[model samples]
Every structure is written in C-alpha cells, then in structure tokens.
Target: MASGVDLVIFGATGDLSRRKILPSLGALVARERTKLRVIGAGRSHDTTDQFRELVKEASGNPALAATAEWVTLDYADPASFAPINALITGTAVVIFYLATPPETFSPILVAIANSAMVTKGDPSRRVVLEKPLGYDRKSAKELNAQLATAFDESQVYRIDHYLAKDTVQNVLAFRFSNSLFEPVWNRNLVETIQITVAEEEGIRQRAGYYDQTGAVRDIFQNHVLQLLALVTMEPPTTFDPDYVRRAKRAALRAMSPLDVTSAVRGQYEGYLDEPGVSLESRRETYAAARVSIENWRWDGVPIFVRTGKALRRRATEVVIKLRDAPLDR
Candidate 1:
C-alpha cells in the first residue's frame, strides 16, 4: 500500500509463513512497531486474489488479514527477481524472510544477487534465515559463502527462535548472575552434565521428510547443540556478539562425534502399513546420545540429547544434574 515500509516473504503461501510468520508480523503491526507492506513471493499457480484469500484463511488472525499483499514468484525463473528489486528502489526498508527449505537457499541467494531489486550497502536491507543452518558444517559453510558473495555477514540475521524463549535466557541468568554457578562450574566441582530431549511420538505424517533427515541433522545439530553451547560457554568479559559467538563456536568445536554404541538411534516400524510410505526405507524415528565437551571447564561432563516424533506428549527441557556435595557437613 505504501512506497517505503516493505516486509517481504520469499515463500508467502507455505506453512511457515501462514502459520507462524504472518501472525508474528501481525502482532508487530498491532503493537504499531512497524508499518508493514507484506510482499509474498512463491511459485503458486493461483492469482493474487486467490493467494490473498488463502493467506487470510491460513493466518486466521484478523489483524494480519487486513494487511496482506500477494505476489507470485518462481526462484527458478530469472525474470522473477527484478520486480521485487524495483519495489525496493525507494527509501523503503527491505526484510527478506526465507521460509523456504534448506535446499532452495542457494538458488534464492543467486537470484537475489542477479536481480535488479537488491540494494547493497543498505543497513535497512536485512535477511532472516532459520536453522538447521546446514545438514552439516560443510553445507553451512557453503550456504554462508553463497550469501556472502552478495551480502555482508552483518546483513544476515540467522534466527534461532529458541533464543527468544524465556527459559533459554534464564540459563544465562542462572549461570552469570549467581555466584553459586560461576564458581563451582569447573571440572573439580561438577560431574557429567546430561541435557536430554526425548519424544515418544511416531512419524505419523512426516515420514518422507523425517526419513531423509534424522535426529542428528534435525534436532541435535541446532537446538540441542545451541542449548549446550549456551549452558556451557564461559562467561564473556563483556557480553558482546563477537565474544558470545566465539565462545559458542569453541564449545561446538570441542565436542567430538558421538559413538554409536553409547548412542541409541531407533525407528518405529508399521508406519507405511497405515498409508503412504513404503516398507524398505529404514529412517530413524528416535535417537539419543551423550555429548561430552573435552575442556578444562567441562572435562568429563556429558550432555545427553534425545528427540523423536509422534510421542505421548511434547516437551523440551534442559536439566542440569549437578554433582553432589561432600558428606563432611
């Protein structure tokens, strides 16, 4: 509707955009923090009118539905990226939200770079990406390179929504704010640290996708590892971005690959017996492993992480099993 304030979505009609993104953006608009002009780009066959209606239904939020714009795009098509660039010509801010999958990331970046719509050296032009950053370290680096070719690392905001949660922030408060934790957190005072995330659910519908990427790539690589990093990272002299990231990367690097014997990777059978999936594929439905950080601070501490689909209840928690005090008192 307006010239300048645009919050564009690369995949507007998808599950991520409709279910979470639109509602969150609507909340921002409701609070009057942003004057939003949502531009939805995807390769849908439907017209703008049909797409808008779809968004209205998908969003289910009355506030966001009132302010929605739909534009069709194909990342595979070279012509699609220019118009988006033209829309960003004025002083309007641009926020590219990539709701697409990990595989589509490279081509999308290439298109954005080749397109006429992208603006370099603009602070307001930000791109938000969700994790699992990559299937592994190599893929993550590859992804970083592709984007770095066109945009600076500072321009990329790698969003881990878990960091936004109150529980996660509380970990920092418990560790740094209290004398109890910061002092006795070393190997001398502490024993093994077990961080477990176990689910009882089976792969009811996501069998196809889940089969391809098991617990390691899906959960441990991002959420569990990130949580462990936050919990175990040394207190920074000053809490700055560079220092915090450095600490995390160091913790991650310190962790070695898990031994399959100590780790349990299980998959529930009879899923394909219900409907779509075939019998031959043996993708894991459940996995649990103990990750040890080989450092002076946490030399023998073991961090256990477990996750699965179609469980009885859905729970995500980190338990710090501290070592017991001596029986002298």
Candidate 2:
C-alpha cells in the first residue's frame, strides 16, 4: 500500500469538520491503518499546533493530531492557496474535500484550478464536494461545467454522506437479495412510501448557510431524493457503480415534478431568534412533499418525503406501507 495520502479540508474549522469529518478520520486511521496527512484549511488564524489540538479534541486520536497541519485559505484570494500547494508533493495522491457552503464552491474551484494541486485527468488527485451542489438545476449544470474545467469527471466526487449509512446501503441488498420482498416491491402490493428525516437540533452555527439553503435545498434535494431513488430504482445489471448510478438516474427521471399543491413548508417557532439569521427570514425549517413516479413499477403509488429540524425527536426512517391482502369470497 502507498505509505501516505494528503487530505486537505477547506472548511476545517466549521461544525461539520468538528462533528463529523474529524471524528470519522480518527476511526479511519485506527481501522484501516492508512497514513493520512490531514491539512486543515480555513480563514481562521489558528496555528499548526492549535489546529492539531483541535483535531485531537474532535477526532479523539493523538496520532491524527501528530501528523496534522494547518493553512490559511481565503476563497476570495487565489494567492492564499499557495501554502496548500507547497505542502503537497507533485506525485502525492491528494484529496481536496470542500466542506464549505455551496456558494463558495465556484471561487474555491477556480483557486484549485489555478493551483498546482490538481492536474486534469490525473487519477492521483481527487476533489470531494458536498451537496447541495447548486441552488437549482441551471446553477447545478453551471457548477458541473466549472468542475469539468478543472478536473475530470472521474476525479470529481459529488458526495452525500448519508448514503454511507448501513441502513441506507442495506436498502439495496434487502431489496435485491430477498425473494420475499422483491416480488411485492411494486405498486400492486404497496400502498405508500414515506421517508422522514427529522432532527431535534436547531441551526446552531449553521444559521448563515441554513437560512439561505432552507430545508428543501439542505436535505430534500439531495439526501431525501437519493433515498427515494434507491427505493424505487430498478435492479441494475451489475453491482458496478456506473450501473447503479444509471439506474438511480432513471428512477429520478421517472419521478413526476413535485406539485406545489402537494407540498407544505414551515419555519420552527424559535428559528427567527437564531444568531446570523435574518430577522425577516421566511425560510422553512420543515418541508414535505408528495411525489409520484410514472414508471410502471411505481405508477399510482404516493411517495411522501418530509424533513425538519427542531422537531419532537430525531429520526431518519423510510416506511413502506403495503396494500391489504385480497379477500376470498
């Protein structure tokens, strides 16, 4: 195995980094025994030692801290990326993980393109981006076009980490491997499918990003839609990633556009009081929609998806209701 790999995280000081990324890295290092050189990049003035301390606290791994480094990166200034370029060697396998908001994606991509960190079509270099990729369809396409300018499609990974959940992955195996479920997985025997992702935690430090993104763009657009696709998509020809992606895309294409009448949006009671949130903000903390797929397997079946924050309890669940058994006269 390669001795080590370089991982540069853009929003290293953010909540996502502290709560999710760093902790995961600790586990990764412990389990896989992979040598990772973690370079935490942000606009913060944290020194290398201070950043390492933060890494140790977040990841609960001293070894990760021992090899950690920090660099100052300002999305507005392309020149700020030089330190990052200097840290990485020419032949090193570098993974640039953009943990910042979607709005900053463009400027950062431009900076990365101008830097020596990425070489087009080089498999050794990769970029991992979090969603929502854009505000809407047109912007998503534009962002994708910009990415193509800097890196090959194969080298760019637009990821939704929710898909990595064991239950989510099991959705595929449970449906395909089980003879009992596969036969009745269609519209004939299924009544409705409900996918709910609820959280008790408020926006907290994510007020700026969450306010602009709202519930739809934050959760519904990528995560909820992905779950729906996995549940409704046809069996792929093979377990290959491309084949699975094609099947998922086909499932999404078959979904009817969400009707305004079938959707509901609301803001939590104390959401306005959150810091950094606009006093006049009307963004929804909760969103629900009734969706349908026109494909033969799913026609006439209602698929309801709802996600919210500061709710009664925290849960992520998918409920598949089955139709009543036939009566014998």
Candidate 3:
C-alpha cells in the first residue's frame, strides 16, 4: 500500500508469473496508481529491456513494463542477490515474492537473509511464498524452520491464491451475512457438501513439475482444502485476517484424516507419454476423497472433495445439498 514499494518476483519468467503475478501487479498499478518498482528476478540472462518486453507482453500494460527491471538471481549463489540488494533504496518497502518450487525456498531465504535488503524486525520488508508449501508434514515443518531463519512469522506470508478469488471470498460473506443461509448452514439442514476443481487442460509445459507433484499435492493440499475450510469454518468474531485464519484452522483441525482406503486416484489416458513423465509413473492426475468434520455444526455431514487435470470441463465449485422437506400430509 506504500508509495515506494519494491516488488521482487522470483521465477519471473515461469508460468505462474506470466499467467498470474505479472498481470495482477499490472492491474494493481493501474487501479491504485501506486509508485511501484517491479524487479523481475530469475536465472535467465535476459537484459533489462528484454525483460520489460516480456512483462509488457504478459501483463499487457505498458505502464507496468515501464517501471520494471530484471536481475539475474541464483538461489545457490549469494552474490546473485547482491544485484537485487543494490536496487533497493534505504527507505523503500521491499517485498520478496517466491514464485519458485518449494525445494528452492531454503537457499533462497538464506540468500535473502544474508543480503542488505532485509533488516531484522522490519515489517516493511516481507516475503511471500506460494503453496504447496512442502511435499508432506515433515518437509513442511522443515520449510517453516527455514522461513523462521530469514523472517519473523508476521513478515512471512504463505499464500494460496485460490482464496483471493472473488467467488471464494464471497462464500464467507454468503454464509455469515445472509440470514436465509446462515440459519440452515449446519448439518441438520445440509446433507452433504461437494467441492470439485476440474481442469480441462493437460500438463502442457508443467509436465516436469506436475509429474513430481500430483493432483493431491498440487491442488488438493492448498486450493481444495482452503475451500473446504472456508465452507466449514465458524463465523469469526471479526473480519480480521488473523481471526478468519483461526476460524479456518479450527475447522481444519476438526476434520477427520482422509481415509486412504476410500480415496481414488487416476491418471488421464496418454499421460505416461507426456514429456517429462516417467513411463511407469504412478503419479495421479486425478484424486477424490470423502472428508468429515467431527464438530457440532458439521457433524454427520459428509464433505466430498476432488480435483483433477485433463478433465471433461474446467470448473471450481462448492455444492451444498440440503435435506428434503417432508411431503405434504
């Protein structure tokens, strides 16, 4: 929200950057009329001018491109971060957004901590990490420890972009604000809740990342779970982000562990032949599971969640089926 904010996006040329980050930043600049310095950081050897062209093309906003610059960054090399540090002024708010894979997070954070950009206890300096945070519970803990070394919990943000979607945010408003729905949102009136996130496109350029991270890790862990939490969470006392997050966490804690035996996993036909996919890979492109929250409000209600790639249609929806009214006597 500040005037002189420096936004350094790692993996600037990656799919996520091209598809989401750059475009969103461009729109933000256009909408807020804020003075933002965009630094596109990647391992690519592209010059500043070349990177600006890429930003212009991806964001479709020349004004965003005009404020953009590029810096070569190597997660393993501390010296690579020097260029990034030099670009930052003493008083500017610095935001480091990691758009790279989870494995690279540790080294990148260490490199950032060693640089002059991050001043300890400075809230103005922040880091944003995109999920899936890690492969599993143990790895996630390790990642948290790594993050702790570089930033305070307050300064570190683990983001699931799905939560930023208007429809998804509206779920909270629809449940809490609508008297018609809020009264009947519990298990007594709601029979079941089904969340489905389907994608029509196959793993096009992300075969390498997709194969390593299947449907469960890629979608179910972050996006699907966040949706489930939003739907099942109790109304927070306040609209503050921390309170909302606590409500979501409470809902997640009440949910039963997924029953592995009842889970379904499958791969799309011809998936094995996709580039970077192993011939014998057992990675699933589709996954579905039955979830239950053992809480007063949601008890006896079944929550079904599923996500997939190369599906019949591309849709993300939450359907709540209510109990039928008694027949007329």
Best by TM-score: 2
Question: What is the descending lDDT order?
Answer: 2, 3, 1
Which of 2 and 3 is the better model by TM-score?
Answer: 2
Lowest summed lDDT window (length 10), candidate 3 = 83-92
Residue range 1-329, candidate 2, lDDT tens digits: 13469899999989889988999999999999888889999888999999999999999999999989999878989999998888887535899999999889999999999976788999989999998899988999999999999999999999998999888999999999999999999999999999999999999989979999999999998899999999999999998999999999999999999999999999999999999998999999999999999999999999999999999999999999999767822
Best by lDDT: 2
Task: Report the Cα lDDT for residue 122, model 2.
Answer: 95
Kindly list the per-residue Cα lDDT of model 3 for residues 235-267, writing each as its tens digit. 999999889999999999999998998789999
Clashes of each: 9, 0, 0
TM-score of 2: 0.96
Candidate 3 Cα outliers beyond 4 Å, as residue runs: 1-3
TM of each candidate vs. truth: 0.87, 0.96, 0.95
What is the per-residue lDDT of model 1 for residues 119-190, given as tens digits with 9 covering 90 to 100?
A: 566677878887767777799999998878877777888987767778777887888999977898777776
Candidate 2: what lDDT?
A: 0.92
lDDT of each: 0.73, 0.92, 0.90
Clashing pairs in 3: none
TM-score of 3: 0.95
